[model samples]
Target chain A: MTETTGTNTRVICPKCRQELPWFALNTDTMSLCTQCGSAIRACVFPALLHTHQPDPDLPVPVAEGDASCFHHAGRKAVAACEECGRFLCALCRINRMGRNVCAACLSRQKHDGALPNLTTERILYQQIAWTLTLLPLLVFPFLAITAPIAFGYAIHAIRQPPGILPQRRWPMILAALLALAEFALGLWIIHLMLDDMA
Target chain B: MTAESPSYQPFGRSTLESSLAYRIRHRLFTGPDHLLLVRQEGYRETYRRLYFRDIQAVIVRRTVWNRIYAAWLGTFTLAILLLAAVLAVKQSPPPAALIVFLIAWIPGLGLLINAHRGPTCDTWIQSAVQSLPLKPLNRLPLANRFIAAVRQPVESAQGTLNPAALQAFATDSAAPSGRGPETSSTPATDTATIPVLPFRPYRGHAHTVLFALLLVDLAHSLFRFHSTAPVMLITGLILSIALLTSLILALSRQAGTRLPNTIQGLTWTTLVYLVLAYSFHSSLMMFRLPTWNHSSPASLLQVLYPPAGTSMITTSFLVLSALMAGLTGSMGLVQLYRRQSGHPPPPPSPP
Candidate 1:
């Protein structure tokens, strides 16, 4: 286990869905859930199987997601903590973002925090629509930059789509591939046009 | 094309084969064994679009030249002999016998032509009837059907049996043994079958022995007038009939291919016919009664062989010849009738 950065705390059991007491577990310190007695992992929520509550303080996990060095907390905030509205010091928290959050407020946050976004499908659709319109007209170089950028914000706009929606991912992926082919052909057309001009 | 697509498809292989079989049963023409009948998807349509319109298809195979020649041989001999007899009897010398011989060519060529794109010929009737369902024909006596099946092919061939099968019968008594007892119980037993001694119900060789009877009649003619020329011709005709019948059976079957072709058999038969007929003419005159011997060669000829007796003799020869040929013709036709009519044994009691 890493040294306690006062921000670390314990949270509920995702498997049994039980609320747990503080200090009951740590990254290396093993224990069980007080309510259900399920073996508890000291690892923060997303890192382990089963989902815990989303962070109330930070924006929902963004596209630029990673182990963040929280300057105020001193512990690396690998996941956003869901409890108190602050990036906290290690000893003051419990596990969040699969890391320990400060001991206090883990249960309060588990009940109150909002969840991660689910709009990947909407983003995927909008990007496909954008590319289909743009790629045919010799505009791929411009389309590539704008579509992927907008794709990010669009993906974050809603909660995660029902897991079932991934079935539609294949056709969209196929569309994306066709778009790539069209982009290449479009470039070839432009090259020919330039050759004719010269 | 669009309608043909299966909305729901069968998943098994045999199911597909059964479907194809069902299609064939509904669509294809089936017929007696000799004229090759084949069922295929595109061919029937192709034929319909061509040589014939009403028929789905028509296939033709011409009679082999030798069979045609044999047919001509029978018809020519019968016609010429009859014409000569008629002229002599009428006391008017009509056209020469050679012209009559030439005229006989029509029967050999014309048996089938009489039907003329129509269905009067029993060959077509029998052929077509063989393929139809046996049920509707329930009114036909079982005996009739049996006789029809066995005799049909032979009857159609005139006196000739299928050469290959009959000769095999001559050489090997067991040659045609493999075909069932049912085939045996019907028709002029194809002498081509190899006799399976015990199982073969003794059918007297009544058909084949008719030749010997012809020879004896020729011999009686020789002793009566004792004319060498008449004796020779009579003997020749008798021997020719015997030899042609046997050898045609042999040669046509082409069974003893190692020995010779039908042409050789036919050639020898024809030579025998000519020689024996020549010998009979001279022998009959030479063997005439002693009292008829006269002074001059002309008187000697008349006295020895009186014109009335000669006419009677010629008429007798012509009648006998026609009778013999016609009888053989009926025998073959009857045999053919029996074959097509004969019922196969009730499906052998399941194992």
Candidate 2:
């Protein structure tokens, strides 16, 4: 009838470094290591802990291409960016003539870094986000220059995630597309207001 | 970013579970919908563990329930098809199409309702097995299996759950009728583990249906309006919104996100009102005049890069398109919810 009866436990949490004065009883608990609270499991009531083995043997190196991406280590990068040879994650890696380009240098190529095909998709998303932003030129002061400049930059960032980017050059494409959308939207509004008055 | 990298498609779906076919087994060809793949894996791992050796057990377990549930769902689908066919045959006017739609809608509603209840009957049996505290086999893979099994009912429920009536169910859905995780024993109190409603995969068929509906609306709007100036704006807005809502919900869910379910309700109401408001007034009046053209409700689609003077029909059609797009998104998400709600084939015994 003892509460900690099933305890053969001298186990401490890998997290807080505190001894868990808890019972395992008949149940095996896959719990965070008690001391550290990192995820772990106590297989049996009397289970013992072993020294850490951090050197998990990853897939054997083929050495055919530069070492696989650190994050997705199994996958081949095939080619690295000429500027920065840093390992790019799949999203970070861009394929041009079959070479991987990292993000930062890619952004430098075009003002905003949109590639050709990406511009259309990004603009579609931009239209939505801009609508949500509701940046009316008349409502805000000093917005005429500020807005175009901002949108020009936003055109670059349409598909940009927060990380190392790949080398890409489609800024011209996104800038032109965004400008067209904005110009069209502006003209339509003017025509609507004038017609309503008449 | 520059396009310097080879687009890495998935070589194939890899999973730790040995017994069950990768539910996301299609990812090899489907590319990396990694988020969806991972969730399916977690569910699959649990599924294979419980019934890995015993296909017979899984069959027996699900046969009665699956047959009944599938029948219900299949019937509703057939009824809807039938009504559509009937309307085409009748080919007369408003009342016949409405009658057919209403008549078929009931069975379609009942289909998922019947499918949704499958997991409820299996609950206590699973709980008993999982309750056997202090065992090695009971650990693992076993516990994970239990979680997957518990999730199956919610999947089933989505198939039967009246989606339109989801608003009504939202209040009671928290402590719902179907079985879910053993909340009492669970260490982590997260909503993802709650198993209230399982997420389903997106089906292209759902989008096709919505596309058809939008086309119908567009035809009506264009023919009714004299001018054709606002077409592009209408087209862009229509396509985007029709698919956006469901896409948002499914993407967030697939990413294993935790948005306030309450917010979903608010969005639902916002959606309903948007549709209501559009129908209530001369929603197309903005395009009535050349001068009145783009600034009006029709011009709302100027957001889609409208021409200087688009037609009223085109503009109204664009709004309609956006609404349908939004519906497509919503339906796609609902489909995900339904798929997640199916009976997780039980996991295999520990190898």
Candidate 3:
């Protein structure tokens, strides 16, 4: 992802290396290369690419009177971790989730999946409700148990926001209805048998 | 620094042109010392300028629209093939239908392959207090060069040597000057703090396998492999279990994350219901049970109840499976629609 910056800052077609016109560069849109006919996006001009400088990250040499990093005794302390109050050298000071954290705190947060910025996994309750409501219908009898559960889940899901993609509530509604109907039908059959026995 | 100097280069442009889509055009201008961003709408224009020293971070994030577009295109093409196959079986089989089906696959494969190539990225320049999103660029090399150009002046202005310069200096001096004396004992980079997660594609391995199994099932059903019903049933049962496990895993992993659970449930339910419905239907067919025909029924009772000589258990299973199949199918379609529209999933609650 990192590349060396040359003195020339012209936006060039990656395929052809020909300098792109001002119109192509400023429009921030994809255009066909004049020579190669390959589609190219002009937003990637040479001037914008950069590798983070190593100086800011380099650990300062510790002197007799200077405060040292908590973890590195030979390095000067640059910043304090916002969460743990640990002294950190330039290399140890991590900017994560808009906070300056030490390596330990960042590691702990990531391990716990507590960092809001990093989402590793998610649980979708609506899918469970939908599955419960509809999947057991094949067995017929299982619907008697699952229908009420599905209906209750649908109501619960309505109050909660959906996952990474929004989903309509109609499927849950349909599942609830179908489950209810199956339950009612089962009860009706039981009542008929009881009446005949009496 | 003056207007007449070659350093004052025009890097971006703003436009007042508005199509039916009402897209707002913005312009960027770059100089040796400063970068200016301008937004023009109709007769009014607003501008902001950032000095080289004040710029903090330049980030380029890849968008998922290309993958979505490719998936949609592939799905559409597959659907056309499915329609052709269904028509060929339901009516007089035509050689032209097979040709159309085979030809439709070429575009479908191309779209999927294109999607696998990844997306063009959107670039943003961030200062301490504000972030400005540059126009999206698809060319990786050009984008990298653009970042490097912006970085060079900013690093120079801040009195910090660029990475290339530092690397060159280190190579020439034959000594590690940046890292302190205790660098040998400590790791060069904090791997734990890197925040790299395992890559999980939208359609995972289980999904691909399930799709393949369904296709095979469909082909078998179309070709009338009645003797292979048991084999189909066993395969379907395995698929059902696999699907159930994947669904549970997916749900548990996302439990605390803010996501619309309904679609996940709908997709799982649809797949499970399809598997269950097909299994039950096949079982009934294997047993030679009389299928209930609503159109030929004499009354409502006949429609609701099994006809004479038909097993009540088999009839109930058939009816329930059909009902579930219809419900789950519609639900899955709704979920697909919501996803395609780019509705934001619910945000995760703080732990």
My TM-score estimates for the predictions, one after another, are 0.19, 0.22, 0.30
Q: How do the candidates score on chain B by TM-score?
A: 0.25, 0.23, 0.38
Question: Where is model 2 more than 4 Å wrong at Cα?
Answer: A1-150, A158-179, A184-198, B1-94, B101-351
| Docking level for model 1 | incorrect
Higher-lDDT candidate among 1 and 2? 2
Worst 10 residues of 1 chain B by lDDT: B45-54
lDDT of 2 by residue, B1-351 (tens): 344322323322242324655433212111111111111232121111122111100100111233434443454455455545645675858676677667776766666655543321111111112211112111234333543442344234222323333322222223434212322222222324422332233233433344344444445434434444566446534654664554344334332122222223323433443465355433444443344435566555443343422543344344444444344335434643553454232243345
Please give the C-alpha DockQ score of model 3.
0.01
Order of quality (TM-score)? 3, 2, 1
Each model's lDDT comes to 0.36, 0.37, 0.52
Comparison by TM-score, 1 against 2, better one? 2
Chain A TM-scores of each predicted structure, in the order given, are 0.28, 0.26, 0.51
Could you tell me the lDDT of residue B268 within candidate 2? 42
The clash numbers for all candidates, in the given order, read 113, 68, 33
| Candidate 3 per-residue C-alpha lDDT over A57-175 given as tens digits, one digit per residue, 9 for 90 to 100 | 68989999988999999999988999799999888998864678998887776555455223323444566677776677676645556677777776666654332223577876676
